[model samples]
Target: MVTQDELNEKGKAAVMDFDGDVVAEIAEECISAGLDPIDLIQNGFTAGINEVGTQFEQGSLFLPHIIAASEAMSAGVEVLTPVLENLSAQAEDKGTVAIGTIEGDIHTIGKDIVATMLKVAGFNVIDLGRDVPIADFVEVVKEKKPAIVGSSALMTTTMVLQLQVEEQLKEAGVRDTVKTMVGGAPVTQDWANRIGADIYAENASDAVVKCKAAFE
Candidate 1:
């Protein structure tokens, strides 16, 4: 029988190698072991992705490595989604968050990372996908009534769409009901302040930390 520590190390290694098959295998093992999917993700897969993000930032790894590791991590998460859903039914929600990229922003890597990390952190996440229309985000906010609304844009051109979401929320009379968080390559805390967003997370780790802090 494989020990949990060994499994954790394997998970980390699989992610660093960008081996989706290996990740899925480990996920299956975890499920069979009756492991908590959230713990598996947080302590195992996320640990690896965090390192990948660090290495990428330090230029030890490139964009392809980041993308591959993300893919592997996502595949592993897919294997555990049902377990996560089952656990969700028995636990109190941390928070409900709606996330999306702006209509003109096709880049979704950063947004996807945040979504997965949020899910692992026990947030009820409604992912609106990349290039989502502002109307759709507002509509979901009005309908789902999540505690936080998150928007991302990798480019300066589409970053303004985050403002549009805020405006739409205000126009729809739901702005007061939810917190707004925005992030991306061109996003800064000052920009978030100027845009009237409630929070500005620098990266996925910061996103989770800020999200937890918002409620705590």
Candidate 2:
């Protein structure tokens, strides 16, 4: 059996190589070896991406490298997600969150970071991706009934779409079903409150903590 450390190391190497297929192969091996999929994601994929994040923030790594690392981590998730989902059925959720970037905001970096951190923190993150339609957000909430809904915006012009989402949720009759969280580069805690968002996160870790607290 391959040790968890070895699998993580291989996954990390795959990220450094920026080879998606290689990352998937390594993740599959970890799964076949009976390692916990979440552990593989954490010790392997997320660990590598977190380093990418650090390097990116420090200006030691370029945007391309950060993109590559995210691609690699996403590839690993493709291989391991089914296994993790099976376990999730039996595991207690730290919380479930429906997350997306608002319409007209094509940015995903901030939302992706929050999703990754939430997953690492044991939350079931249903990421709706960038430029999501308002109906999609409401539909997902109706289906998943998550503990929280998170919307992110990068551009100031697109920030109002978050409010649109809130209104849509109200019209759909599930506005009170879940707490709302909003964040992005230009978003501040006061702005979140002003827009009726239940909370705001300056970064991914903060988002994860806020999500955990919302359910507690």
Q: Which structure among the candidates has the greatest lDDT? A: 1
Best by TM-score: 1
Candidate 2, 128: how far from true, in Å? 2.8
lDDT of candidate 1 over 1-216, digit per residue (tens):
877877888899999889999999999999998766656676688789778878877889988887798799889988987776666566567989999988998767678768876876789899999999999988988899998989998778999888898898999999999999999877999999988999998888799899999979
Per-residue error (Å), model 1, residue 16: 1.9
- Candidate 1 stretches greater than 4 Å from native: 1-6, 54-62, 93-96, 104-124, 153-161, 171-173, 183-191, 200-216
* Candidate 1: pairs in clash: none
RMSD of 2: 4.9
List lDDT for all candidates, in order.
0.85, 0.80
lDDT of 2: 0.80
Candidate 1 at residue 90, lDDT?
63
Model 2 residue 187 distance off true place after TM-score fit, in angstroms:
7.3
Candidate 2: residue pairs that collide: none
Question: Across residues 1-216, which tens digit of lDDT does each residue of candidate 2 receive?
Answer: 788888888887788778999999997898778886666666677677767767777898987887787787788887876775566556566868989998887767568757866776678889999999889989999999998988998767888788888889999999999898898766888788777888888877678777778878
lDDT of 1: 0.85
